[model samples]
Target: MNFVCDRVAVTDAVGIVQKAVASRSTLPVLEGILIKASEGRVVLTGNDLEIGIECVIAADVSAPGKVVVNSNLFGTAVRKMTGDTITVKMLPNNAVSIKCGNSEIKLNGINAEEFPEIPKFETEFDIVLSQREFKSLIRHTIFAVGTNEAKLILTGCLLEASGNNVNMVAVDGFRLALKKVVTEESSVSGYFGDVSLVIPAKTLRELNNIIVDRDDKIIIKCSQKNVRFEFDNVVFTSRLLEGDFIEYKKIIPTEFKTKITADLKSLIEAVDRASIIITNEINKSPLIMKISGGEIRILCETGAGAVDEVVPVEMTGADIEIGFNNKYLLEALKAAEGDRVNLDFIGPINPCLITPYEGDDFKFIVLPVRLRTDVSMDV
Candidate 1:
């Protein structure tokens, strides 16, 4: 394999594909990046069985061949190289030579045939949406994906489609986040009705980094077992979780006993301040919210200190007090959009539901933490 490519362009492409390179694997091939040189371009691919990322960049290819090299060594070497162009050549015995300006390095390479083949989908169904919209869908709900491996299904976010409307939902055991958007157009052709998929959070996070906030369209192709995302000379594919996702509709509360409307930024600031006292002792300190008299008072007591804060709000239904894990409440509030947000409470013990004050585009539910008897709520 012999290829000469722009230093910056190849470095960026290498970084992009390296996200899928296995950090720790028994098979050495899984930790290597495959480089394929063709007529006028070079393709780099990294796959770790669960997810695979491929990037193509323009290059001058003197010889058409392929080689696999350690992703970590190649990425670091390419990034640190000094010059406008980089030349790569595969020598005898699978040894690879890399040269950029005055720097030169010979990296041991694996035969390209050893790399695992990325699955090719037969394109059963597909959906189209702008990169901005797709990124928003992932960022809005990815925080709520469960980390517990026992319930493997909860580790991924659910993507459900009906007509042109799409809903992305993520739920941990303690909280749930839902984002709704309308696609430019909808396609669920191979299926009888709606199409649902559970996509792993790790894959979505990497994809979010790859897709920029642009109006350019992105194509999502789905098959029986794998899903592929094609955008900007890059293809990202991942296997869908096999089990059924939780029934999210049943989990969201329909009726509420209390409703409070507050400025989103102000509420976040208040909670953030309350969290400071218990930042080191999160398990022992619970942020307390006392809702009454058209005002929401925040209180927290911990081994370090205590915090008493007040933020005005518009309230109706009934006055209530609730306790919550500081981190969970803050994360939901940070993810919420719009200048103001509405909080609907079923009671002090039930989950607190949060939504935008104006639109029904998003909903977040955070379960309340049970306050310990020793902690006093004085505000």
Candidate 2:
């Protein structure tokens, strides 16, 4: 393959596809990126069986050919090169030469025929949404996905579509995050139906990074087996996990005994500071939150020391004291966009539901830690 392209465009495409390249795979071809140059465009693809990414760059193509080159080496060399243009040419000895400015590097290349072919969906149900909206939804929920391999389904995010709305949910047994947005149109022809598919969190995160700044609308096409995301010059495909997502709504409490509103920045900083001291203990010490009389106090203690912060809040219902992992709380709080956030606690042991005071679309449920009474206590 021979093509000349902008360094920035090639670098971005390489970085994105590299995310899907297998780091340690028995199949050597899976570790390399497949480059297809034809019809005045260059296509880059990387796949590790579960997830695959394809990116197209507008290039001046002199020859039509395809080759697979080591993704890591290619990405590193391209990034280090100083030039506005990158020229890649396939040689007769099954090797590829990358030339930029005064530097030229020759790398061993594999036959494109040996690369695994990614499946293409024939019949697809499509949904349309802006890049920012889709990216935000993934970021808000992907962090809560389970990482355990044993629970394969939990490691993926649930994508459900009904009528004109799409919802994404992720949980790791201990916590759950659900985010939804309404769209004006959907090409999915059904009776306001919902398709529940578990998409790997890693794929979702990678997709988010690639489409972060893309303002154009994205087309999400899905079959029963794989999900495809297509935009300007990129296409992402991920294998769907075959399993029923736990009925997450059943676990979310409908009501709460106490609801408190506090500044998101203040709460995040307090929890972060408390976590520093709490990590010293054996049991992974938890942060305690006591809400009473228009004030909320957060406390945590360990072998090193303890920290306490009091922040004023607008609260109602009975007073409640709760314990939770400071890290979990901080993550949920980081998703809070507004200055004030509302926390709903049913009891000291039950999961706490957090949301922005005026927004009802995003919800975060964090399971509380078992309160330890041995610590120095203050009400």
Candidate 3:
């Protein structure tokens, strides 16, 4: 494509689309970015079969055409350019020339026709949410998405939109994270019901990185197999995972026998200190919490060392002792929005539910680690 574009704008667009470029693909074109110059604008697209990202930037299009250039080479060339504007042109024999100031770089370009097309969806529903809200939703829930390939469904987070509410749920067998928010707007075609999509966590994570925290709204369009996110001058599309997500609602316990209101920062700090004794993953130790009266005692004993700390809390119901993976509990606590949080415990073996002191915007369920009483083990 022949286009003269603002160097900064093109550099930003290249950086955004490069996230979707296939790092190691059998198809050479998939490793390159498709640039389409048309009518005063340049469109850049990157697709890796699973997720695709497109960015549009205003440019002076001298000759409207399209070309596929290596993403790394083109991006680096444009970013290092010292001029205010960059000139890109298609040369003979599928070669692309980039010029800025005195620097010129020529790259072998693949025919645009070889690049795979991003899926076009006949959208059945659309949900509108603020950039800040959507970004927060992904950050809160993505940590719990499963990494196991055997359970494919758990690898993605469930996205549900109904009424004016949007909910995201993720589970990794050991823990579950749920975040709900009120949407700016939601609409659907007559044939479709409320939007229910299991979006791959990886796609959402990438989208989160691109999204800025603003009051500006993001439009999400959902189809049968794919979902599209449109905001500003960018469009993001991803193939949805095919399978039934876990019924997370049923998995969350409604009743608890023990509840404690603890300072979120304090609890997190205590957990962090206790986990310091766990030097390696091979023999990692759990953070043990003994809650009673108005205080909670944190303890950890590992082959490396032992830690003992305390965090005062407001407790009710029966006192309980619980053990949990240090990382899991710390992540859940960090994801919480408020300063104080409530932790609900069913017993030592059951899951621990964490929620904010006030609103129900988020909920986290972390399963307790079972402590083994071995003769050689010390508490």
Give the poorly placed runs of model 1, Cα more than 4 Å off.
Answer: 187-192, 279-282, 372-379
Q: Across residues 1-379, which tens digit of lDDT does each residue of candidate 3 receive?
A: 5889999999999999999998877889999999999999999999988899999999999899998999988999999888999899999978999999888899999999988999997987787888998998899999999999999989999988877778899999999999999864553333346778899988998999899999888888888789999999999999999889998999899899999999999999999888888888876677888999899999998888889999999999998888889999989998998889999999888999999999999999999988775213554
**True-structure lDDT of candidate 1:** 0.91
Quote each prediction's TM-score. Answer: 0.94, 0.92, 0.96
How well does candidate 3 score on lDDT at residue 271?
Answer: 91
Comparing 1 with 3 on TM-score, the higher-scoring candidate is 3
Candidate 3 shows a clash count of 0
By lDDT, the best candidate is 1
The window of 10 residues in a row where model 1 has the poorest summed lDDT is 370-379
lDDT of each: 0.91, 0.86, 0.90
Candidate 2 local lDDT, 1-379, one digit each (tens) = 7889999899999998998999878888999999999988999999888788899999999998999999999999899999999999999866999999999999998999998888887645676777877887898898799989999999999988777777889999889999887766762443346655678888888888788755588877878888888887889988888878899989989888998999888888878888888655466878889899999898887887989988899999999888888878888888767888999989887899998789688899999877756334433
Q: What is the alpha-carbon lDDT of model 2 when measured against the actual structure?
A: 0.86
The stretch of ten residues in a row with the least summed lDDT in candidate 3 is 184-193
